[model samples]
Target: MSFRAPHDGELLKSEYALRGFLPKADPLTAFPCGSPYAPLDEIGRDLPSLLYDKGFRSYARGLRLPPWQTRVSVETLPLLRLYYVRIGFLASAYVNQVGEEPVETLPGNIAAPLIDVAQRLRRPPILSYDGYALYNWKRFRKDGPIALGNIDTIQNFVHMYDERWFILVHVEIESIAAEILAAIANVKRKLAQDANADLNRELWRIEGAVRRQVETLKRIPEHMDPKLYYKTFRPYIRFFDGVAYEGADTAPMQFRGETGAQSSIMPMLVAFMKIAHRRSILTDHLDDMRAYMPAEHRTLIKEVAALPDIGAPAYREVFNAILDAMASFRRVHYGWAEDYINRRTDDPRGTGGTPYMRWLQQLLTETEARRL
Candidate 1:
């Protein structure tokens, strides 16, 4: 099958270079105070304390929150991202904070801004991976590496350090994804020209990056206690099922939670590596997750997916190594699910609202079978 090449791969390369995948969703950013939007900022700054107080739901329901009805300007995108995070966190807390059962409706004040920002951002209105992880961190020191201990979360539902660690672990993973994204950027030109040697070189680079990503991902349990993670902060970001928005014209929305599924790293890699997962309920959920990622990232995955297959013998080995790294990530993830979520409850649905144990097995088998 022939794929038409973009000019000089500029569109492809520049898309991956945009850094939307990083914490540059802005640590230095905040909405201006006492403006119409100040309520969200104040609520965000007060989230941890407010969550502990039994009055959190009352306080959330009582807010004179902004409608944010104006068309979002391109210049305000960074601050807009911060707006989504703060308001999204508050909304999650409102739903899951101290309820007999998680709330089924978002009040008008809470729903309006979320519906607005999420539509403008081309993602679901709930707190998906972007709000919960990618944009959730800020480096403690300006010059510090974006690694564990150096990074901390900007927002949380609880006061535990495990919450911070859980979010930061994903932040660190996103940071390592830069190298893999760079390798992907280079491959567009190689594929366009049929430069098999260069393509093979990039396949190796991607394999190394995946291995490094796995190494960093393995550090999740270092400071995050599984019980703390499962019990305290996890529920705030759990999936939305038939949840209605009070004032918006929108009907009840069913979106996945703040999940690892929404991360673009693996989806982009699966697309780039030419690994096609079998069609199943799990694969459909995986495809649906792209709707919650940044639109440019979704586009990039499609671009990478369109690149021709690398099926040579040597290319196959590098592909297998990358799959090995992916499998290792999956194994660690399995241990996490077992320790953090599965053992703790009888419910089969994970935070992402999938029967993940069965899904993961399918994933492992598919990855092994798709080598070259």
Candidate 2:
């Protein structure tokens, strides 16, 4: 098998080619510029300014209710909004690539000029939601969403091939997760004002969304054949090494450590599961791990930590939903790791090969079997 290195033009095309996905511009109507949210390509250039604009600030502050609402909203909601756009762009590329009757590299005519701006700024693109703050930026937004667009999809297919399959899964979970957080915050404010407020209705809304997103995973096994993921996409993931070519190179190096979404996202989900059990497990490696999560997410974890234990039924529904999502994510990666990473690779650490992957599968399997 042969792989071509990522070229600059391909990167830009993947991120900015939004014309078809976006509605055509109509200049005569009110707000005739078209939906601000449409033509998602422009967001890479526009989102940072929008976040700092005074009007956006006012819109963010307007969401704060009950005066006692956690200040986390100032950062969390807006950042999550930004993530929705990124996920949509990545998903569009992924669905179009894989869903094509004949799967092929995005044709050259369609793949150039994709958004590779982050590499020019000397930072990785903010593809996964967890580590946006770490990237180099032209203008800082202070725990706000990074303005980088991830054109990794435009690179050699390996960088994201199978991972894209799971990322759409992750994106859905995070997308709906933003809604769940909003509902929970709303319920908290309502309860603060009136102790007898019917929070069940609000909580049930979150539970239903979570359950539905989890069910969406049933489609994964159909699109992602294990052999395909192992042979095609799995080889593209990198651990460390920051090559200078960056976007033009498929295996650009990393400065920190490995940050495959599979691992980075686990700690956040685990934090929620721990909250359901009324256990706090911060101040260690777990705390270090969560630092990659957005400030809003970190703040929400702290807020959940503060709630008094109301017994299982009080939060059981949401807890189960989160747990189900976490377990399902683990299940897919576990299968991938076992089938590929653990199969024939020799141990570089000298203990054994892929021990952590085996341990993770065992742990997740055991956790999923537990009753709430």
Reference-based TM-score of each model: 0.92, 0.46
Candidate RMSDs in order: 2.5, 17.7
User: Residue-wise lDDT of candidate 2 within 193-253, one digit each (tens)?
Assistant: 6655556666566556556545654445644666766444433222223322223435433
The window of 10 residues in a row where model 2 has the poorest summed lDDT is 20-29
Write candidate 1's Cα lDDT for 3-33 as tens digits: 3444553324543454427744345445665
Which portions of model 1 miss their true places by more than 4 Å? 1-20, 23-25, 33-35, 69-71, 193-197
Best by lDDT: 1
RMSD of candidate 1 to the truth, in angstroms, is: 2.5
* Lowest summed lDDT window (length 10), candidate 1: 2-11
Model 1 TM-score on a 0 to 1 scale: 0.92
